[model samples]
Target: MNMEDLTWGQFKALLLAHPNLHLQFKYAEDALVDASYHITEIKKAPITSVDCGGVINNWTEIIIQLWEPQGKMGGDAMKVEKALSIINLVEKALTLDAEANVKIEFGNSTFYTRQMYPSAIAVHGNDLIVDLRPDVTRCKAINRGGSCVTADKGEECCTPVKPKVQLIDLAQTNCCEPGSGCC
Candidate 1:
């Protein structure tokens, strides 16, 4: 499929409406399994101070704050180095195992995050936790690290990853939102 043909809005909208649009993740060892989560939220922090929330580099995995920010479930409260470390894990794994996939679970058995972000994970001071949601099942297509099973059920393979985690890589962080002037 020609990704260039699809706009982010179209792509995301498709995802939101898709019956199989699900998320997946990996761990220390073992094939990538679906991650379980209680809540999810998106916040913006300088790439240098971002511990969770929002996708860092466009190609890396997405992050959700797992700690409460001043008693709020969703607010600015994370560290950048920590965020990069998590991104590094995903990059490292994708490089070594291009076939990796991730799964995410949400609270209340909803495939999507609750309208009210749950503060459970964040209250513990843990980084954003990765997991699968109950409402949606899985994304329909997977060209990169998606689910343990490829998007098309044994059709597409993962994309190649560039070398990462080197010190120079961290210094080269760029804005991720294309054309939005953020990156």
Candidate 2:
């Protein structure tokens, strides 16, 4: 199933009902985090930025941070019910936006720390597989409009224009040279 199709709240509700399911995160084809990882923190990140075209953009995300404890080995993964309990605890302390997008934050000595979005979810035997994809940068202005800068492709928008340079002959000018009286 496409995990992106569901909001954070809907996903949490699904998990809460599936008490026996196990979770495994696949960051890449070869990069997988098994049950040894712990849900260290649940955060609400609100981001606001001005795009290259000077338009302001704002959004929020439910950030889930996973940590693999040192010297930990393959073990029974955290159950879905246990994760729901953690979420409940977080909700008690801080309000979470149910409709906000969900992002998983993880990294290791070999992998740089980064936030990834859930791309897909699948059930493999007894495990719930979550495939995470890296977020990409896009030109917000272009996405919101046909032109790069503005919607109307008017004077404020970016348009291709031929470059021109005017050449001036210093000798033909009235301005004086070092010895000229016009100096």
Q: Write the per-residue lDDT of candidate 2 for residues 47-110, one digit (tens) a residue.
A: 8998767689998889999997776688778887788889999999999988888989998777
Best by lDDT: 2
List, residue by residue over 53-136, the lDDT tens digit for candidate 1.
211222222233332223334323233343344545545554422212222222222122321211111112323322222233
Clash pairs (backbone) in predicted model 2: none
Location of the lowest summed lDDT over 10 successive residues in candidate 2 = 151-160
Taken over the whole model, the C-alpha lDDT of each candidate is 0.30, 0.79
**Which ten-residue region of model 1 has the weakest summed lDDT?**
115-124
